[model samples]
Target: MDEIIRQRIRNSKTLLGPFPNFFYEKTPDYPQALFLEWFQVAVESSVHEPHSMTISTIDQHGSPDSRVLILKDIDNEGWYFASSSQSAKGKQIEINSKVALNFYWSEIGRQVRIRGNAVTMNKERSSKDFLERGKIAKAIALLEKQSLILQDPHELEEALTKQLIKLNRNPKLISPSWTLYKVEATEVEFWQADKERKHIRLQYNLRGEKWVKNLLWP
Candidate 1:
């Protein structure tokens, strides 16, 4: 079974469609602006979950850890994602603030990688975000102890029932540990894959308060 899975994966291909006419001429001029533009294009193309991204963080032992997370927001402030302060990712960020984000839209043959520093959002803003979340999401945040070993699966189920009651009583209740983290990008790379494998790689580095752009070899 393992060999079958490996063979299928190894034989699969990418970038098989007729090359889009503008792809060859397109160059990343402004990193953030290009990102927003590409994101909208992905949406128009019906790419599923365009705002989902993989975030990588360094654990205390210097090992790398990563998980897929929904992108909450983006602007001149880099990117935003939410987590609990006691979550595995949150603890890792506390030990080391440096992190990376990866966005891939296979339907568009595009990817964006960002390396940056992460900082917790202010309490008021974090609270607002929590309040905006659905009741079930709020109940999960109230759990606070994520990624923990469970002796029984029903433990969380029972806890969630109690939390739902609490939320029903006070919809405004907010968990102190639920936090929003923002990444301030120091380097951003935009990649576009070509059928011929001569991929485009454009990188932007933040220096002082400005961004310097450079083209990278395929």
Candidate 2:
């Protein structure tokens, strides 16, 4: 590992700080509302790719995999994103509905962690979402074989060309197995940046089918 990583690890082993910024936490009963406020702020600010989040999943062999994916939708129910059912993350969700999602806006030094159960939306809904995408996205979707092996780059390019030609002929055709899945959070954590080292952390938990809030250490 790098020397900087080693140094950071050593620093983490100790508690040292001037500690002060838990004061920005929002008022009672609306943790999600606070998240919305921060998200809106991020959108209006200069932070690039604010919608990108780390999607954590476990493979069939139990190894955890995490990669950044753009957020597609958000509502009171949860966050949504679409993928091919054959993709590794998609397959993992099918095998185990439980997963974690993390959003970190480093420019603003804010982060959100969500633990939830994923539910695949209906086929029609998935198709509608796919159809609504831009032409380049649609073309790329038709080309990339998510999580599948590609032996030859030229072969893959040829396949993409063929698919594009087909797409040009009839743009209405939707991938038979495309899917949109939503991660319905049972727990959510909101963390805000600190001027001093303290930072602000708030967590919401689903207890007996109801959401309960609690403060947490930074």
Candidate 3:
């Protein structure tokens, strides 16, 4: 059985791309601009969850943890995402602000990796972000006990019901722990896969308010 599974894994094909000719493409001076261009392509290509990305954080014990999250916004400041301050990832961010974000669009055979420091936005911005969420999402945020052991499933249902009721009464009620975080990227790498085993990797490094771009060996 193990041999069969191993063979299946070994035979799996990857990096098959009718990929863009990024090798000859002119890249922007800023990583953000290039990222937006690639993101627009992904959206037009109908890539599933194009805004979804993996955010990796370092825990208190110095172990790396990662989870998929939807991208909230992006600007010159950096990439934005939201979460509860009391959640595991939030606590980890408090301990160590450094983080990495990865976005993969398999259909396009492209990926973007970012290493940066995450900082909490001001309370006004955070509250605005919270209010923009759907009622169900707002209710879940109000629960505020994320990553805690749920000994009783019924308790969650009851808690969610209560929060929904509260929302109905006061629509403006927002979770105090809900926070918006922005990642200020120091390094960003863009990778494009080729069918012929030659992949293109371009990296941008932040250097004293300037961005330096270089090609990397695949």
Among these predictions, the greatest TM-score belongs to 3
Q: What tens digits encode model 3's per-residue C-alpha lDDT throughout 13-83? A: 88777776685258898898899999999998899999999999999999999999999999988999999
How does candidate 1 fare on TM-score? Answer: 0.94
User: What is the lDDT ranking, best to worst?
Assistant: 3, 1, 2
**Which lDDT value does model 2 have at 181?**
88
* Cα-lDDT of candidate 1: 0.87
Which pairs of residues clash in candidate 3, taking residues 3 or more apart in a chain or in different chains?
A: none
Estimated TM-score per prediction? 0.94, 0.86, 0.96
Q: lDDT of each structure? A: 0.87, 0.79, 0.94
Comparing candidate 2 with candidate 3, which one achieves the higher TM-score?
3
lDDT tens per residue, model 1, 87-113: 899999999999999999888788899
Error of 3 at 81 (Å): 0.4
lDDT for position 207 in model 3: 98
Worst 10 residues of 3 by lDDT: 16-25
In model 1, what are the clashing residue pairs, if there are any?
none
State, as a TM-score between 0 and 1, how close model 3 is to the true structure.
0.96
**lDDT for position 181 in model 3:** 98
Of 1 and 3, the candidate ranking higher by lDDT: 3
Candidate achieving the largest lDDT: 3
Deviation (Å) of 209 in candidate 3: 0.8
Relative to the true structure, candidate 3 has a C-alpha RMSD (angstroms) of 1.4
